[model samples]
Target: MDIIKNIKEKGDNMIYILDTANINDIKKAMDIYPLSGVTTNPSIISKENRDFLDILKDIKGVIGKETMLHVQTLSTTCEGIVEEAHYIRDNVEGELYIKVPVIAEGIKAIKQLKKEGFKITATAVITANQALMAAVAGADFVAPYVNRIDNISGSGVNVVNDILNQFELYNLDTKVLAASFKNVQQIADVSNLGVDSITVPLELLDKSIEHPLTDWSVQQFTSDWKKTYKTDKIIIK
Candidate 1:
């Protein structure tokens, strides 16, 4: 079966996003490929060990005004989450997406944030139920922890599929932003499943475009051409 063709038949709305907060990494990755946006949690931000808002502004400066920047709120309560959302918007400029976890308070916070005219991304999602609730709360995107779900003996792709199906059934505007991938295969599988977006690590992004046979074929072709033409450089003049 043609898996790619099958995936296309379902529709092609997938977007590749970078999941990092490092300014150097963002600059490098953006130079290498077209990324829709960048995502960051508290953990990812902590790794940088810089001023929080300054780092966010630096990331915004690197990505520019077009690319979406998703920053998570550390608050566990609805009131605090809403307050943090305003702070993030006040500090970071351009297209922004506020990531709230899919917990009891988070769902409540999402509703409030939506009412306040903020773009919300319901994160830390592991189950279809959480995704469903997040969608019902009017989230712009729902992020499922792919590898993290697998660590708990559940199928991440299945969770993604279930969330997609639920959205289609209800005609919800919330799209799935599949995250926490450890390998390219996971991305390929999720892509085939018709997810709306994916946040990939920079290493996996490089690995996704590489294959042993492709390199081998190129090497063989170059060797044969050099043998016949007796040159390694192409001279236009």
Candidate 2:
């Protein structure tokens, strides 16, 4: 039997979600790659300078019904966060994942949202304990900030590995979505740890898949072909 190691199912595989609110970038990524979904925060949304609902709708329209669109809440209180989540769910069409910070109030909100059968992603996680707690509280996903942890002289890849260890130890089903990267190498490092997903910026993600060597190789092939045939063609005389 031939064994293949690159099958990527959306829920089970290493999901590739673009972390941007720019409409054009989302569309371009979807067109090029099998993008799993999208994630957005207030900062990312504010960069567009459009009405919040309009932006969400535009993104949903582009991603369609199957792919999820995760939106972060602005409230610090459990009640406020729950109410805000409800409002967003009522307005946003299709599958919407609410992104709550892995804080005290967020844990409470996640519990309530889980009871209500809402898909929740616990964000702003930095430690293994935080991700574990979010998983126990019924968050479908936990997003760890890889580069932010590294900026403070910590190993982001190690932190992600620790989180994965705890989840396996406790047999938690919560998916780990690594976020906040500074470069493409960070992505490779995190993915090496077998993270369930990654939400990357369009610029760095684009850079990750391209190289000067690839362009040079194609140019060389074209040049060699043209030198012999006068044109790059399969027709040989």
Candidate 3:
């Protein structure tokens, strides 16, 4: 299967968030490869200063077809939320996943939307119980704000683990997507625990491939290459 299809097939296992804070940043991030999909919020969209449809179109263009592009709903009413979800699905050409908060209204919207065959993601979840509620509401993905939970107390990672454990116990299909990642350690921690997916910031995603030793090793390799090539040139082709 293609990369996008593979990523989506992994579902709860692999999730990459778009944290460019704008459309242009999204484009740059996708250029790096292995970008499964993007998660966007109202705050991130506000920085773009463009209509939601315009921004969605630009994101779909850069991410291409089969990429799961998540957009949060602004309305609190179930009807309004469904309306917005449908609007986004109709307007965007790629795989559009509607992000509903884990509030009561959002849960109502999620159940209704799921019945309508619309993909729904439960966002802003802070606890294991909230994640359970999202799953019971028929959410395709339950996102736990890891960093935010840690900020309040230092148990965000534990919360994510608890959710994962519960889901396995009940055999719920809803995937636990760890969100609000603050650093590479958080990603490593969650990934190590075997959580379904992690929606990380762009900077942290880039940092995941780097470490002090890796950077130093690369610098040393470059220096050695320069010195070796000074006397004679070696070309592959």
Worst 10 residues of 3 by lDDT: 1-10
The TM-score of predicted model 1 comes to: 0.93
Q: After superposing candidate 3 on the true structure, give the runs of residues whose Cα lies further than 4 Å from its correct spot.
A: 1-13, 229-237
Total colliding residue pairs, candidate 3: 3
Evaluate model 3: give its TM-score: 0.88
lDDT of each: 0.90, 0.91, 0.81
lDDT of 3 by residue, 21-62 (tens): 466667777888477788888988888887878888888788
Worst 10 residues of 2 by lDDT: 1-10
Q: Candidate 1, which segments miss by more than 4 Å at Cα?
A: 1-11
Sort by TM-score, best first: what order? 1, 2, 3
- Largest lDDT belongs to which candidate? 2
Candidate 1, residue 115: lDDT:
94
Error at 216, model 3, angstroms: 1.9
Q: What's the ranking of the predictions by lDDT, best on top?
A: 2, 1, 3
Clashing pairs in 1: none
Cα error of candidate 1 at position 16, Å = 0.6
